[model samples]
Target: MTLFRAFFTLSRAAQRQLAFGAILACLAALANFGLLFLSGWLLAGAACAGLAGLAAQQAFNMVLPATGVRFFAMMRILARYGERLVTHDGALRIIGQLRVACYGRIAPQAPAILHAQRGGDLLARFVTDTDTAGQYYTDVLIPFIRACVCGIFFIAITAIFSFHCAITLAVALLLCIVIAGAIKARCATLSDRLSATQSRIQSELADTITAIGESLSLGASFHQQSVIMQCQAELSATKRHLAALENGASSLIAFCATLTALCILFFAVKDFQAHLLTLPEVPMLVLGGLAAFDVMSPLPTAQKTLAQVHRAFDRLEDACFSNTTAKSTSNDKAFSDYSSLQFENICFRYSGQEQDIFHHATLCVKQGERVAITGPSGCGKSSLISMLFGFYPLQSGRILLGGSDVHTRTPEDLAQVISVAGQDFHLFNGTVRDNLLFANPASTEEDMVAALHTVQLTDFLATAPNGLDSFVGDEGLQLSGGQAKRLSIAQALLRKTPWIILDEPTEGLDATTEQHLLEQLIAARPDATLLCMTHRAAVLPFMTRVLRIQDDAFCPSEEKKP
Candidate 1:
């Protein structure tokens, strides 16, 4: 989409605030130009009356009319304040909307798609792209509109005084716009390079930060630091080149505008000397033309802002349309139940890879049945579970729930039926209850306590003073590893879906705790289907069947029932 269309697609609140901000900015520019013209007229009128040897009273009367000029100045100040207020308000609102849109679009994307994208790269897009899009409305679009309005008004006023001056101003304005456009065209290549470099730098920075401990342990801190400096230096060089381009363009435009103003002044003076215009009229006309030139001074700066806008637009375009898989499909239903799951000849491969992760993988789980899957690392165990949980698309197979294909179901419909607790659990910084009831907002305190109890967390909660209301630090940092894992399982249990897929559910727990937690889980949801990935053989007796992922194929173990 074009920049303006994208801008208008922002939330209505932001659009309305931006519209008000633009109006205020235009009014401010008008008042500023009006004040300048009035001041000039007052000076010329007073000079003529004073040179004619009028009395003090006459001089005072001549200059008294300029009092209205002060009023315009005040109005200009107020308009400027209003413009700033509205602009910032609009900017912040747009920032929020852009962030929401970016994340919302990325959330439902297939895991294969997300896996192909680097975490650091995605973070940069989320933070930097949203920031740039916000500038499109605040600094570029609104100002451009205001400038056009003010430029036209100033030219009209100048026309009444001297048509030559008006024509000269118009030509200068047009040249500035044309040059700005050319600069924008030229900067396109550089802007894209800069944006890519920025993404790389952000990715490197995130990696460095996340691996700081590793670097230290490996005695490679110096090497990582050098790499970080290299990225920083590259970014600095890119920005320097951008700055130079802007400065050069600004200088050339300023020269052209100055030459145009000088030409207007020369013609006006010559016309007056030849008695082609009255003396009072010459000063009035020259002053008005000069005032118009003053109004054009900010045009070059606006051009620079426009260039930034172009850069921002390109980033936004990438965010909105780069990977089709990132777009979220419509969700018209809510998650409520999970009764059964079936996978038939399901196939999938990682992007840019030749080998398929899952080759004709097939499985079925009846209601209340508990199945355990065992596989070597990287044998598509997690990938298979992700597909089962609607986190990835099958390459050439069908996933069904209650005899219906899952692809035909909305996200909410899938959500209502299946819940998953993956190995890499994420917890928001909030109270324990907040993390537990994340899926169901209407879950009561009783429900929260029950879930905690099922996860064997009631003993810990009772001693924590705050119980379910206890604050878990960022990502549940304050909680022990076992506690964090149990919390994630508790969240899934709280959803109360018909199917629960747990990946490494007993990881990081003691042998006793693992067994106890597994028993509690089995007891808590006697009617729910369970797909658990585990390596511990002790839990095998509790499972109804075992599926082994061997040689990239899912095969049932040969433990036959009598």
Candidate 2:
């Protein structure tokens, strides 16, 4: 879709407010013109009458002209205030909606499709790009509309005095608009480059902050800082260039407005010399024409902003809605019964890697069976689990759950069927209660307390200042590594799905703690099937069958580890 069409679609919900804001802007512009035009006419007519003597002065009604000047002045002030209030409010609403819409479009395709994208780049699109798009409405749309609306009115009024003056003003306004468009086109590439530079800076800063401890310890801090500084310098340079262009455009626009005013004055004076105008008409025409040109002065800056808006929309579109693969046709409904998982001659490889992680590998886990897959570190064990849960696509072959392709089910349906507790589980920067409720919203406080007790987090919560209400800092930084892993297991247990997949669930815990955690998990949901991937022998005793991954294929272990 075109950038303008996409922007309009996103802003549709606030159409009424935006339209009303535009009307208010036009009213304000016209009121300002009236204030200046009437004041000039009133002053000139009063001076002319006074010079004609006492009878002319008495005949000239100063009361009506004076009242009109006051009226226009009040209208200008009130309309200006109303215009700013309405337009800004509407623009903020659009920005909020744009962020939400972008998130909604990109969320379902996350990690699976967005695995190649940097977190900082995506953050820039969500925050910075959305804000830039919102500026289009306030800085470009409303100003352009106001200028056009007031321009026609100004010409019509001028024509009432001298058609030649009106023609001069109209042609000058059109020339200014054309020049503004040309300047905007010229700045398009710079605008695009500026946006990319800002994203790069955001990305570099985000990466540095995330790994500050590692960088400092490894003595790579200087290198990382240098890289970020370089990005910042590039960003600053691009912004400087853009500023120069905008300033130049503004100066040219101002000069054009001045020239247009002079032309209109010259036409008015010529008409006066020809007896086609009076002294009062001459100043009224000149002042009114200048006021109208003043309304068009913002057009150049507004046009420059349009270039930035275009680039913003382009980045937003690429991040949120581009290159998305459609889900395969299959049953959208969640499985109603406990079903077996089957991998049929599957072939898989990671992106940008030549080696196959799995080559025609096949495996099955029968319903209600406790199965464990064992492998060394970096053996694609986690990748296998991710594939089974539909996180990655297979190069060849199929993964079926309950006799249906896993790809056929929506994330919602798949979520209902399987729950995973992995080493990389994320925790929100919220109260413990909030994170717990995320797994199963229907779980009660008592249920949460019981689950926490099962995972041996009861002691930690007891020591917390507010029990379940205590804040678990960003990504659960408040908790130890072992505590976070236990919390992840507790969340998985809370899900109560038909299938549970655990990745390195017992890697960091002590033997006693692991044993207790496993016992409680088995007792809590005895009917649920467990599929665990672990490197430790401690988890083998709980499994009915232990399969070892070797040569990219699963083989039944000769004997279960004691």
TM-score list, all predictions: 0.90, 0.96
Best by lDDT: 2
Taking the tens digit of each residue's C-alpha lDDT, what string does model 1 give over 1-562? 5544656688475667778888998888888777766776677667777787747436456535577788889999999999999898888887887778767666666464566666788887778777876776666776568767877987887777677777887888777677666667556666677778888878877887878899899999899888778878887987787778777767777687668767777766777777765555565555555555444555545555666556666665555455534223445755333466778887887667798888887777788888988877787767765665556656788887777777676566677777888887899999998887786788998988888888889888999868888998988988998899899998998898888888888888888887788788888899888888877676677789888887667788754321
lDDT of 2 by residue, 314-363 (tens): 88888876644446444655587557999899988876789888889999
Please estimate how well model 2 matches the true structure, expressed as its whole-model Cα lDDT.
0.85
Clash pairs (backbone) in predicted model 2: none
Candidate 1: RMSD over Cα atoms? 3.0
Q: What is the C-alpha lDDT of each candidate?
A: 0.74, 0.85
Model 2's TM-score against the true structure: 0.96
For model 1 the TM-score comes to 0.90
